[model samples]
Target: MKQARPLPQYLVQRFQGWRATTFGENRSWYRRLAEGGQHPRAMVIACCDSRVHVTSIFGADTGEFFIHRNIANLVPPYMPDGQQHGTSAAVEYAVNALKVAHLVVVGHTNCGGVAGCHAMCSGHAPELEEKTSFVGRWMDILRPGYERVKDLPAENQIGELERQAVLISLENLMTFPFVRANVEAGNLSLHGVVHDIAEGTLKEFDPVSEGFSLVG
Candidate 1:
């Protein structure tokens, strides 16, 4: 019979440290969150990159935001064909059930997923083009974004592609009927942003100007 392995020593130590410090100090807060359930004010759809710390960036307390992390932070156009859709399910729950007022799609610089999509589009990453490659299929969601940036010089494409991913996701988010209903009703707001990981800065997208403005 197969068996599962225990967590590594470092992770165990880290968990113990958190329990003794962060959790210890906020025991009541944690209990209240557990009891009251999560009623977050916003929903953040961000990249799965480890450096993208959603809660820390916003200085959010526990249960303050419903976060969904995915490769390249891409959300496919709504297709209710009944196949498994992790990202769609998260958005649906956050919008319909949680009724979050704000939905933020965050992209970032030097994203590996964006790089992979670029490579595949340029025919440099053939392995990613295989039909059976899950990452390839997921990255396909960014093809429209790729088409917009493919002609840019090599050094510039990645950065622009990353931003494109955010815009693409924001556009895709509207395809969901529930999200659209809430947005049209003025009950939900959709925002797009790109983070420069090294500089610790954010560029917010403006629908009127169709450009990204650096946030002070």
Candidate 2:
């Protein structure tokens, strides 16, 4: 019989600290949340990068934002093929069940996933070209975006591709009928954001300007 291992000491200590301090002071609020359930007004689809602190950036408390994180914050086109689609499922639940009023797709600078896609597309990473490479296969969703920036100089291409991730995800989100209907009815709004990791700066996409403006 196999035995289960204990959690890492660092994580255990951190959880204990939170339980004793943060949770202790907010016990009543936690209890209320447990009973009342979450009714967050926004759904944030952001990259699964440790540096991208979604709640911290927005100053959101627990249960305020329904967030889903994935590589490069990419959203594939809607495909009702009855396959397992984690991102799509999350989006569906957030839109239909949670009835979130806003949907935000966030991208970031120096993203590893975007870098990987760039490498693979530039014929620099032959290993990712193999059919068995999951990252490469998943990154196929960003090929269209990659094509748009492939012509730029190598140094400038990555940043443009990173921004493209947000644009592509926003464009793909509209492909969902529910998302489209809600957006058209003014029930939900879609936004694209990009975070500059090193500079601690944020930029919001403006459809009118067709560009990203730094958020003050």
Candidate 1: the clashing residue pairs are: none
- lDDT of model 1, residue 156: 87
lDDT for each residue of candidate 1 in 1-216, tens digit (9 for 90 to 100)? 368789999999999999999999999999999998889999999999999998888899888999999999999999999899999999999999999999999998889999999999999999999999999999999999989988889788888999999999999999999999999999999999998899999999999999999987
List pairs with backbone clashes in candidate 2: none
Q: Once superposed on the true structure, which residue ranges of model 2 sit more than 4 Å away at CA?
A: 1-4
Q: What does candidate 2's lDDT look like per residue over 1-216, in tens digits? A: 468888999999999999999999999999999999999999999999999999999999989999999999999999999899999999999999999999999899999999999999989998888999988988889989999999999789999999999999999999999999999999999999999989989999998999999999
TM-score of 2: 0.97
CA RMSD of all predictions: 1.1, 1.2
Query: Candidate 1: misplaced stretches above 4 Å?
Result: none
Most accurate candidate by lDDT? 2
